[model samples]
Target: MPLIYQLLLGLVLTLLIPLWPSNTLPFLHLLRSLTTTPMMDGISLAQKAQLHEVADLMLEIYKTLAAMRYIDAQAINPGPHNVSDLLYGLDPAVIYLYSILPYIDKDFATNTAFFNGGIFADFRKSDDVEQGRDPFYGSPSEENFEDEDGPYMRPWVTPLSLLGNHGSAIVYDTRQHHIWIIDQEGWSSTDPALEGVEDGEPDSINRNYFAHIANRPAGDVLRDMVRWYRELKELPGGTEYSDLCWDHWDMDLKSLFEKNGWPDNFDGDAFLVDQAREFCALRAKGDAENPLGEVKKFTDWKNGKADRAKKAQEALDAAQNLNETWKARFELWNAERSVLRNTEELKKAQQEADRLCPNGVCQRPEDLPLWELVAVQRELGWKQNDLSYHRDWAEKSKESDPEEAKTYRAAFYLAEKEVATYEKAYEAAKADADRLCPGRSPKSVAGIKDLDQDDTMRDVQRRTELDVILTRELDALREWAAQIPPEANEAKGMADNQIEGLDKSVEDNQAALKKAQDWIAEEKEKE
Candidate 1:
């Protein structure tokens, strides 16, 4: 990765970190201290676990957002689509919605249906499809399931299908027709639906099934459904079909689902469905009372829905941020581990190199005398190539290593000295030659000039190589030097400050917790 990208990632990670299970060195120590005991008090354990889960969720959400931070928010729209479409609609905030969704397996064909290509798409996977299968028909597809109320009632099928997967509670605003997918999750856990169905009444079977379904496009399906439902009732609960458009589908559908033997889970789904019914009831009371009065009623519900939506969005955003921070921290930590492993490998290689070139492992003093004899033979020109080969081998043996820059710095200095001596000698020889045979021959004069130029160029090349070696050595030294421990006092000061801040924050939180507990106790006593 580029340094700029690493810096940017670091900045992002810093900005979005969780309170618990943090990778920040200071917090890691604090967390370790908190979990030192083998066993924790049950309540405390639960609380800590909850906190961890929340943090993890937050981190997951953060990761999701970071992954999708480039998406155009307005362009993202999910419908009665599949998981792919739902994913397409995912904003950073929508990622949180996914964390809480039921199905995640892409292989499960049942969950393939979804309202839009967002989190709901996950709910509409193959597995979910299998689970939420319409017992009434062997095939779960809309084409296969015959519409009992005829073509005019075809639109009712989607709302009814949505009722099954997401549960019955949903709301739509009167003005903009803003739709909120009510989370009736907790309701399912405790709902009467867990009770077994009576014999010969399959429709009454207790099903914990919640799934998003694939259907015709959301816009067309919804518009047609509302149109059909309004026709089904001469008056939409005493209101005209004109009033029961997209804006009224939220209410009318809720009532339709309830009237159609939708199980009353007694969870929030049931509550919200009832609420929707109430709002529609109020709307049906007509405009004679006060237009502003009706507007207030609508706004009140709108405000509540908006508040829920905002909380859901916040939870999603926090989860995404938290997930992203942890992922980066993990990636960096993994990279660090790789570096450590490479360092170990390099050490092994060095050990092997040292073994190959042991000072007294193979050669003795007698052998050294033979080497000297060989050198003398070379100097006498017994085999000039053989002599050159020995010299080259000896030089390379000294030079061969990535660490040569550090190890050969002193050697480079000696080489520099040798080059200086050669230059001085060559200069003197050139001067003597010029004085001894001035203008004796043109060829001779040109030969001296060439020697001077060649000598100068050779010196420049040697110096350049020497400088390169020195620079490499300097860089390696600096790199290794940076690994040294910081001053004790400097480290201690930072540690003290961190501990102090952590202590203060913990104390404040404890105090607030105690106050909350006391208030709860007092309120219970009063009750």
Candidate 2:
């Protein structure tokens, strides 16, 4: 029964040993890891997704632009002086499509405003006036809401509101993959509340107050849409549009959109097809076409337009797909960069800790005083190495004295403590350096702009402590190395070779460190 119990205990011990936790390092390592880990890990997956979306959208716009150019080329064949039948048909589409293209499927543009109107707004904000005229020239006045040409023609390129002379809003719902047009009561429209009306009235503001126009006759609407679309393409999400909404510190989503040259509310569709307005005016002039003839002509025009549109749509789809591909690649690149930075940071923290503490003896008074954790860390590391070497030596030496093998067992434990001390000191020094220098490393500092400042002094002191510790730690390491006796002629030869190489490396490292010190001094002098 006792034998069985012992066997069970041994099995438990063996299993638990593999699961044993590592001894804790200094508080600094923990602190640095805590502070930096979140930043590294905080990268939003949504950001990658957004980048891909932007790239996709840009490519899509590029394709659409290409198609428009193709259509334009067809319209202007045989030199550049005459308009073709195609020109008349394509003009309205171009004007309308291009006007809204810049703002489509973008988070930046307003769903109900025109891009030109936005530009005009900005021009007004800068107090710009055309030819020394009032800044509001041609714009709607408080008393006269109509533009110079009346409600049919707006100072801005938006469509006439059915209820009033207001701009309509347009947006592309990427999720639903459909265009959404919103009606807004134009500035000319009187407010219902002011007229003592409430919600839910047919003409209430809550209704789809903005008119929905078509992308048929592109003319002004197409031109504006194309211009804005091209402009957006230049943004980072566009071609240069920055990831920061309004820029890094801006919190307003709408402002960010506007800054990127997108409409706060797009209404390109309202102006795209002003057929009713045109027809009404033409009918009033008694020049309207016979209904039967007009219908036949309209069918022919519509069929031709549909054929071209189908082609344009196919090109747009291909472009959109390409854009998505590019975006995906960009996201992957960003993700990789982020991961690499995080890994490098982690490695840097570990290296810094090792540098501060050469020997692992955290509790030793000498280890505490030296603080040259980096220089001493190798020495501390050697304790383990030397102990291992000694154990191997002792194993072979067992032919001479079996007890020699046992001697390293205790020293191995001492070596572990010594290594721990060095580790802690190294970690602390690294943390201090990081705090003092932020991103600038001591070795990389070419000048000391703030050398004499209190902040600089704190870092300098930490560095100085590290240097002093390094000096003393090396001396102790030499003493320890000397004590490692040769077990055999072969062992002695190997130890001698290793010690010689280590000594040379140490000297070279010290010389390089001295250069770093000189740089610090130079910076101080300049200060």
lDDT of 2 at 329: 32
The TM-score of predicted model 1 comes to 0.15
lDDT of each: 0.34, 0.34
Candidate 1 ranges with C-alpha deviation above 4 Å: 1-222, 225-494, 520-527
User: Residues 409-501, candidate 2, lDDT per residue (tens digit)?
Assistant: 444444444445445544554565466546644334211123224434555555565556455545544554454344334434544564576
Worst 10 residues of 2 by lDDT: 70-79
Candidate 1 lDDT, 207-272, residue by residue in tens: 322222111222333343334333432112212211232134444544544454433222323332
Q: Candidate 2 at residue 84, lDDT?
A: 25
Residue 46 lDDT in candidate 2:
29
- The candidate scoring highest on TM-score is 2
Worst lDDT 10-window in candidate 1 = 150-159
